[model samples]
Target chain A: TQLLEQSPQFLSIQEGENLTVYCNSSSVFSSLQWYRQEPGEGPVLLVTVVTGGEVKKLKRLTFQFGDARKDSSLHITAAQPGDTGLYLCAGSVGTSGSRLTFGEGTQLTVNP
Target chain B: DAGITQSPRHKVTETGTPVTLRCHQTENHRYMYWYRQDPGHGLRLIHYSYGVKDTDKGEVSDGYSVSRSKTEDFLLTLESATSSQTSVYFCAIARGLAGGGETQYFGPGTRLLVL
Candidate 1:
């Protein structure tokens, strides 16, 4: 089974602070995706990185895929209260790439 | 936002009761999945279907069963509810097979509490 482990299970910061969440695994993946979930709602996809060392930016959030395809990271620049939520990383593995293994997730709270 | 909806948004039931949750999608995606989320466990797959009458177990499938009798409807059933089964269940649809880097769109989620 493919497993993704996330660091800093919980985080709280003042508005304007920068934070980085890490997702690591021993197994390689064909592609990786990041998701953000607010309370009482299902997760919303943030971005997907398909190539090693690829980086994608969405407004204030930047997502990076590991060079080895075994890890990924999400960085928030000048985080605001709106950025507060649970961030999750999921990887697509196996021969068919038909399944996604997700990380436990990091909860972020940006206080205004 | 991908035309996915789950019925009985919230349900509370006693132990040993049988419960079935319904997931309907208007996107007509070919792949559908059932996942349960809990505090400390991000999301664990319960079951997934590649097509009608074609279903398979997932990582945590022991207590749950699923059926896809049509293109747009997928149902998850709990034979005997237990308190340990309390969690937020989500249904997702993807246009193509997973692992191909296809984006999976999620529903609003159904909150189930087994008393």
Candidate 2:
């Protein structure tokens, strides 16, 4: 099984600050996905990166996949209090039916 | 918000008791998954179904079993609940895609407490 290791397990920042969370793995994956989960609710898919060195932006959030397909990162610009949540990175290998391997997650807290 | 719902949103039970959790989706997706979320452990897949009556175990499948009789419903059961099983459970549905690009929509999740 592939294992994803997330850095900065916990982060606390004031509103308007910027932060980046990293997800690293020794194994290569076909795709990498980012999800943000709020308290008391399940995770919601934020984005999927299928190509190496790919970068996608969602408003103030930016996601990037490593050129080696063994790492990914999520960067939030001008973070707001609403951005606080648990961020998870999942890697998928092989075909679509393959299961995803998830990282422990990064708990982000953007204080007002 | 993919029309997925989990029954018994909050459950409290004792050890050695049998417990069942239900996941129902209205989107008629082809795949469904059951996962458990624990502190510092992230979400670990327990079981997944690709089609009706076709199921497979995941990374953390011990002590749990799943059954799917219809495209919209997946059931997960714990034969004998244990304290280690206390955690929030989530159900997800996805329309399978190639190259593992499919996005999974999750339900609200069910919080289970085992005493």
Candidate 3:
């Protein structure tokens, strides 16, 4: 089983502060994705990095896939209260439609 | 926005009873998956299907069974409900859209409380 471990399980920061969440794994993946989930709602995909050392930026958020494809990072710039939610990273292995293994998640709390 | 919907958004059931959760999709995607999330366990895969009548066990397949009789529907059944089975259940679908982020879309989720 592929496991993705996330760090700083819980984060509390004031609005406008920047934050970065990490997802580490021992197994390689074909692609890595980032998602933001709010309470009572399903997760919404933020970005997907398919190539090793690939980087994708979505407005205020930047996503990076490690060169080895075994890890990834999500950096939120000028974090706002709207960013407070559960951040999860999922990795796709082999085929494009293969099952994705997700990280435990990082709960971000941006205090306004 | 994966056009996925999970029924029985919230349910409470007694132990040793059968419970089935339904996931419906309108996107016509070929892949569907079921997962459960706990406080510290993030989301763990229960089962998934690649095509109609083609299914496989996920990491946490024990005590759970799933069926995909049609391309649009997936059913997850709890053979015998247990308290430890209490968690938020999510149904996801893969779009595989070109240039679209290769991420899964989740349903609103079903909150099941087992006694």
- TM-score to true structure, per model: 0.96, 0.96, 0.96
Q: Per-residue lDDT for A29 in model 2?
A: 92
How do the residues A22-103 of candidate 3 rate in per-residue lDDT, one tens digit apiece? 9999999988888889999888888879889999889999999999999999999999998999999998886556788889
State each model's CA lDDT, in order: 0.90, 0.92, 0.91
Tens-place lDDT per residue, model 1, A19-98, is 99999999999888899999889899888888899999999999999999999999999999999899999888743417
Best-to-worst order by lDDT is 2, 3, 1
Q: Per-residue alpha-carbon lDDT of model 2 for B38-67, expressed as tens digits?
A: 988899999999999999999889999999
RMSD to the true structure for each prediction, in A, is 1.9, 1.5, 1.4
DockQ of each: 0.61, 0.71, 0.66
What DockQ was computed for model 1? 0.61
Candidate 1 residue spans exceeding 4 A from truth: A94-97, B96-100
Candidate 3: list runs displaced more than 4 Å: B99-101
Which candidate leads the pack in lDDT? 2
In candidate 2, position A75 carries an lDDT of 97
Between candidates 2 and 3, the one scoring higher on lDDT is 2
Q: By DockQ, who's the top model here?
A: 2
TM-score of chain B of 2: 0.95
Candidate 3's docking class is medium
List of clashing residue pairs for candidate 2: none
